[model samples]
Target chain A: MQQQVDIGEVVLHHAADAYSFGIDPYFLLEWHAWEFMQLGPFNLTPTKHVIFMVIAALLVFLTMRVAGQKLQQQRANENAPKGFANAVEAMVLFVRNDVAIANIGQDGAKFAPFIMTLFFFILYMNLMGLIPFGATATGNLGVTAGLAIMAFVVIEISGVVKLGPVGYMRTIFPSIPGLSGPGAVAMSLFMAPIELLGKMVKPFALCVRLFGNMTAGHFVILSMMGIIFLFGHLTFWNWAIGISVATLILGIMMLEIFVATLQAYVFALLTAVFIGLMQHEH
Target chain B: MLLALLQEAETHGPNSPFEPEFGLIFWTLAVFAVLYWVLQKYAWPAIVGATEERERKIARQLEEAERMNAESQAALDEHKRLLAGAKEDARALIGEAKTVAEKEREGLLAKTRQEQEQILERAKREIEAELGKAIAELRRGAVDLSLAAASRLIDANLDDAANRKLVVEYLDSLEHSR
Candidate 1:
């Protein structure tokens, strides 16, 4: 008898956040959500994505802490860092100089820590999904939205701090050049919603871009893997298809790694740009 | 078949990626907040501070190196200038010494020549005087011999002063003729 493979079920099961961790036919660890704390309108249950998020956070914190310490030690010794510390330093400097400072101008260094944290945290979360028995926390919409919302808050707050309340209002209601009186006022009124939408869109794009890229990569890999088992019988064609699909999946996995890093960089870069734009409105 | 699969995926209602799970968002916020707070409190300061310090140190070192290079170059230029001045001074001193030595040698040579000429003139005057005296003595001896022969011939003594005067007049005539 040919085994039935529900491709959609397999893909959804792997791609979506779940309250249980499963390796399928080998091991399964299901969580009882009711056992966890329940606040008003909030369930503090540890889902697969949440657990992965913690792992990612812990990984980032510990690694960065070590890197930070090593950096301090290297500074004290007045010598360059080596190996992992060096790599971390390079990344930190890149985010500081290229991402944050490059986008945000002189005051960008103040925002470097936030940008660097977002980058590494998102990076680790994206990478975790590729590992066996690991789920991508960033693949979840809620997680990406949370990150985006935080970034949005930072961007807007920085803008507010840099440009006073009146100046921030001017950002929404920009003065049109060469036009004054009623014309400029009409232009400002017309541009106001657009400016506000533009503000919201920056973070929205950051959220969806990251979430989509991560989730889509996993979907493609799972769908490709599903193709091999789609044929009912184990034949020569099936083995050939399996081999081809595996190769394709490997290629995609490589691309996914690149995409993960790219998405992380994009998010950080866009956030920096938004902060910069807010600081310097014209 | 793919469309059917997608439709089937859509049927799994709660699993839709678009569906916002408040629990997951809350967890994300909590985790991210904690991570951010922890990192901001500890890791970021060290990393950023160290990196900035390293940058400042590198810039300072470069500035120091440039300054040192300029200082060394200036010192080298000063040293060269001093060396040139010393060389010029030494050359002038040598030239002066040569001129002084040349003048002193010329003066000593002139004095030595004058002394040699005077010695030659004195020796010539002395030889001439000695010759004149020898000649006078020889003439006196000849006259005395002549007088003695004459007296012997005459076989008598004549007046001494008159005879002497006669013999001197004869000898003067004979010397004049020779």
Candidate 2:
């Protein structure tokens, strides 16, 4: 009897975060959850995603640092940067000009660094999953949520600074034109929760959009590949199916790479837009 | 297969995508915070500062170029004005010189005419005086010849004063007749 392969289990196992880092078929580094660092409801354990997150952070840090030094040197000599430094400068300028200032207005220069950090960090995390034996840190809901929350904080704080306390309150409870007395009060009370929900939804959308896109791309690729193993035995039909699916996977991977870059851009762009929205009330 | 996965997903609660892991979130926040701080402090300043510096340098250079252009333009205008003024001055000088030369020529011509008139008047006066002298001398000789002729004809000497008076009267009569 041929044993059937459970594609669902395989996909879920690969998509989800694990304590073990699997390098190859034989090499696997198992990590035990840190029991002593349990504080309240949280267990601070080093997982696969955590390791990748650290790697991504380190990469972003080193790359930016080197690029920054090169830029400073080039500027001193009154010369343009070349190669890797130029590429990094291009990205940095795009985020500063197109994403930050374009959306967030003239005052967007202050938030450019934060937006740049988010963009590169998310980009690196997304690309990590595409490589062999590497996991996507951004694929995890928690990580995306964390990033979204930070963006949310920056957005709201920018509003508070721009609009002030009273003006910020007015954003949530807006006064309609030509409405007076009790009617205006009633309307303001009614619109408050909706306005607050609108604010919350921006970050929520940012979080789910990144997480869903990254996870779904991986899921589709894995499931398609798993289809070849469905036959259980290496028959001619199975081999043919495997070759066909592998070709399809290649195409999907190209799309995934595009999506990875796109999602990072979208996240940064939306965050800037949200910050811009907060700067001025409609 | 979808149903089977749903059932399996329901059983596997911890590994589910919807389930939140506090530890993962904590780590993410920690890593991100460190990244943001480090980058904001060190990396960003160098890159962004250089960009701003370059922009400032370009702006200043443009301003300087504009200033130089304006200055050169003003200088060119002044030079053109000076050239026009010099041309005008030269024309005026030539016109003045012509007027002076014409006046000097007229003055010289008038002086020459006055000197020519004076010389012609003196010559006329001298010629009249000489003509008067020559006529007197000729009259004296005519009287002498007449007396000698009369003496020879009469073969005697007559009184001179008496004959002279007669001769003078005869001459005066002759002059009146011509």
**TM-score values for chain B across all models:** 0.67, 0.73
Q: For residues A205-260, what per-residue lDDT tens digits would candidate 1 score against the true structure?
A: 99999998999999899888888777626666877777888899999999999998
Which stretches in model 2 have alpha-carbon errors above 4 Å? Answer: A1-3, A76-78, A232-234, B56-178
Off by over 4 Å in 1: A22-26, A74-79, A232-234, B1-15, B56-178
Q: Best by TM-score, which number?
A: 2
Error of 2 at B158 (Å): 74
Q: Write the per-residue lDDT of candidate 2 for residues A1-282, one digit (tens) a residue.
A: 357877899888787787778785779988776789788877888788989999999999899899989987887799878888888988888898899989998788888888889999999999999999899988988889889998999999898899999898998999889999999999999999999999999999999999999999999999888777775366658768877899999999999999999999999999999999888665
TM-score of each: 0.70, 0.72
